[model samples]
Target: MDFKYVPTTCPYCGTGCSFNLVVVDGKVVGTAPFQRSPVNEGRVCPKGSYAHEFVNAPDRLKTPMIKKDGKFVEASWDEALDLVAEKFAQYKGEQSSVICCARASNEDNYALQKFGRCVMQTPNIDHCARLCHASTVAGLAQIFGSGAMTNSVSDLADTNCAFIIGSNNFEAHPLAGRRLMQAKKKGAKIIVCDPRRTPTAKQAHLHIQHYSGTDIALLNGMMQYIIQNGWENKDFIEKRTVGYEEFKKNVMQEKYSLENVSKITGVPVDDIKTACQWIHEAEKTTAVYTLGITQHTVGVDNVRSVGFLQMLTGNMGKPGTGVNPLRGQNNVQGACDMGALPNVFPGYQKVTDEAAVKKFEDAWGCKMPAKIGLTIPEMLDTFADEPEKLKCLYLMGENPIISDPDIAHVDKALKNIEFLVVQDIFLTETAEYADVVLPAVCYAEKDGTQTNTERRVQRWRKAQDGPGESKYDWQIIAELAAKMGMGDKFPWANASEVFDEMAALTPQYCGMNYERIEKEGLQWPCPTCDHPGTKVLHCETFAGMPDGKSVFAPIEHRPPAEQTDADYPFILTTGATIWHWPSGTMTRRSESLNRDCPTGWIEINEEDAAEMGIETGDIVTAYSRRGEVDVPARKTPDIKKGVMFMPFHFWECRANWITNTPYDPVSKTPEYKACAINVKKKEA
Candidate 1:
């Protein structure tokens, strides 16, 4: 058997760990560690190790399928493209929107947005970022003048102390966890604050189990304590930031008292002081968070609190000293950077900006829409309206049916839409409802660039050919654009040409090209070819603020939309495990991963399990006002009492069935972390 090793980036999480696909006789057989990778350095998580298995899974969609009289029939690319264009032409502006994928490459997403704006002529374009770090992008951009991770992944090694909250980094971002482990090896303090005692928590210098949805209070309390103890960075605050006085007066002094904050957050006053002390004592501290911070009614405020703590500690503009939001999907950051959000064009350029609009219009030779579009939730919600406002939806690599909050509502809305087009490698749950399903290539079949959590744009080389009739997401989109009468506008010869177009428009990626990224990827804000990519942002000044200073917003804590009552007596939180991923569109198809994880299980605190007559391995039914799901109970003390945790990986017992839709006002991110639910033992 002829054997070859192909180096590629992981398609699972935002950590962007690199590995080699082990090919035998022209077939992908397994994965080998890419030891030379700057991100992972040979270490890979369980998912990355088994990533190759899903690329050639038996269930992968091999050809386009169009639904005729409620039955899916295999069709040629021309037939499918003609039908899609015909249906899409019936809708206009707000009525037609495209939901791009977080899993696709940067080139794929950039093309998706370009097609949506120029060909479809709709400002309504968004992605899964609406479900995840939309709050991070919104809140951080307003406060820090930028929205992405402020430091590179490797910078975690230089941290004096790491204050990790809201995320189970070891599970969700394993490569980043490796860097934190390196920091610990060098004696850097690690503090974990979450409602659950995650694997990362167990490794921390301090683990403070705070109440769900009270992150703002907890952070403000710490800031108050630090300021009270004279640990506030007076010099840094005065020189580099704005609105400190308003924040200090309104939040720390007026609203939050150590006693009041402790009472609201359900964390003891002493533990809050201890967390503050660690931050106070450390010279270079990094604040890392994930969905737990963003999936709340106060998500924007929650993110701002993390920013407040870091800025108060003089942590910006340096290595190992900035607030880091570990993104979920591998290319979610890249998707956002490529302008998947409705309100902005690529590189966070506003749709309303006359100059930016004129620039893009000149480049594309088409007038751009000035009005911003609807977010994902808003797009889905529009379908529920009488006479249906949204006529068509073009979804790429996203499974909104399983991933969106309130699946029942999403189901009804999807059914009401006039036409739905889904493009993905697998026959996902969302694809089951599609009027037309376009077969798309998996990462193994595509050569493209993906920006990781660190804003490092790394190239994942094509390892093998895709199965019959399947095309790369970008190719399918470009072909669709061509059919939709935009053939002359999209003249991309290859993925490199697409990247070049994206880099030319997006200032953050101006310096990036396939050539520079081939050897070692560059972190963005690269700007020019002569300029090396930026490692740590805001080294000299914050990005694009009116006064070149970071702003500290005085945010107050808000309770979750739905609180535990006599009917729904438990607080439910959802997340992904190390063995499984969100929606499980890709991971569930993996033989090894499925063998390891098998199915979904709800993590109930031992005390709650006993109270409900539930035991480990016992089937339990968890229901909220929205819907109910039954999964085997996993009795553990890892989670806080009265709080139930489940991973939204398996569709058999979708955790989103019970997740609430109440969103943050500023960011529109659903309050997935603190929904109220009730649980009961299922009779055998």
Candidate 2:
């Protein structure tokens, strides 16, 4: 038996730290973090350290299969690709859709995008960002020159203060949590403003549990405080930033006063003043947030509100000072950098723009659609009402059944598609309905690049071969292309050539080659052959404006789309547990992870438990207007009263079943955070 240690980035969260899989005798035994890696500093979250076990699980798909008479039967690659070609070829140049994932590596992502655009010829393609940060991207990109992190993780260590809103970093980005703790150790003041008492808030020097969906009120109030105190960095504001006086007049002189903000945000005036003081007086300050800020009816405005506050305080250029959006998945930043969105081409360029479309057309040797594509939520709306309906659905590496906001809608809307193809390593809940299942290689069995939360692209190395008859995704896609007479587009022999093509087409990745990333992974905006790649974007200017000035949009607080009502009197907040990734695709495959925590349970405060006549481990029925599911109740102090938390990793009990299907008007992202539901003791 022989083995090799290959250092690669994680496929889970966005830390992008290097790690090595213990490939013992041509099989991956375990994963260990790179001790010398600077990003993780020789540590990994529980998920990052153990997410490799699923590579060779017993339930892994071992052979390519086609659904014949409603049963998956093993077949040769030629037979499987022929079947896919027959179905997809029928939909070429039709109104079809391609839904991509952030978990996919760089080559895979680029291939999937090109497959949809060149093969399908529809701009109706989008990735998970449509669900997670579509609003955040639209929000921050409007203010900053680029829609990425303005400050890197290293800046957290160098900053004097951090203003966090609408996120639970402790459980979500645990590695970032350690850095937040580091900043606390270095005597940095942390101000957290959220409705829930999250782990990050518990560590904050000051925590303001503001009312849900009142982020704008809290931010506007803080801006007013800074103006009254005259603690703003006036010199930096005047020299670097534009539109200061008008922003001040609107934010400071508006009828929406601090008293009104205190009313809307449900925070004391003094507490708002204190938070404002820390941000205003700090020599260097940075603001950060996650999905909580972006998954809202006013998600776009919520992001701009934060950016406006930061620009007003002069937190843009210097170390420890800027707007940082804590990204969720490993390559979410990369997927966007590759133009996985419907509205934008690669590198965040608008698809409707003639120049951007012309660039992509020239590179791919095909004409692109002039209109932007549909988002997942928009696609859902089409399924909900429209007729021409999305046919021939091809889902790669995403499980919307367990991940989407509304479960009932997912079940019905997915039926609107004519032909369904699911390409993954495991038979995911969504894949259960697939007419064609292609057994594709997992991350450990494939080598490519993954961009982290900070837009840092790092090497993803393969440590083992695909078990049984499974093949790399590139091979599967190429064979399908060949069967459909588009094989010439994918002339590459390996994934490296795919990367070369992606870098050639996408300008942000233009300079990044396999050899370069092998030496040291290059972050996007590497733009040219010799560019070192941008560490922090917009160091000298913001996006949109000619002189690079941030725009301040007028905003106000609104209640969550679905608040606690009489029938369903509790507020349900959904999130992922430490041991579970989205839908538990890889996490559920692990023996240790399952043993640590299994099954979904509604968290009840000790007092709320008593009031509801619910005890620990009591099987209860959680119901809403959309749907219902039964789960045991767990009373814990981690959550506040009247608010129940549930992990969305399990499929048998889909969390989205009970979630409201409220969408943000601007971001079009479903509001998965706040929903009204009732929990009761399950009848015997």
Candidate 1 wrongly placed segments (more than 4 Å): none
lDDT of 2 at 259: 89
**Highest lDDT against the true fold, candidate:** 1
Give Cα distance to truth, residue 286, candidate 2, Å.
1.5
Score candidate 2 by lDDT: 0.79
The numbered model that scores best in TM-score is 1
Error of 1 at 529 (Å): 0.5
Candidate 2: pairs in clash: 144-543, 145-542, 145-543
User: Model 2 over residues 1-684: C-alpha lDDT tens digits?
Assistant: 787777877778766767888889989898876786657776888887787777779999988778888788888877877888888878755458788789888778778877888887887888888777877788887766577777776667777898888778788888877777788889889998877777788998888877666787788778887878787778667766666777677677554577888877678888888888888668888898888788777788888888888777778866787788888888888888877778887777788888978888887777767687888877766765663756777788888888888877887777666788889889888887788888888889888888887777788788988878888777777777778788888788888898888788777788888888775476667889899877666766664467776665556667789878799888787876778778888989888888888777778878989987889899988998888999888887756667787777888777788987788887788887788899889877
Q: Considering summed lDDT, which 10 consecutive residues are worst modelled in model 1?
A: 380-389
Assess every candidate by TM-score.
0.99, 0.96
Query: What C-alpha lDDT do the candidate models reach, one value each?
Result: 0.90, 0.79
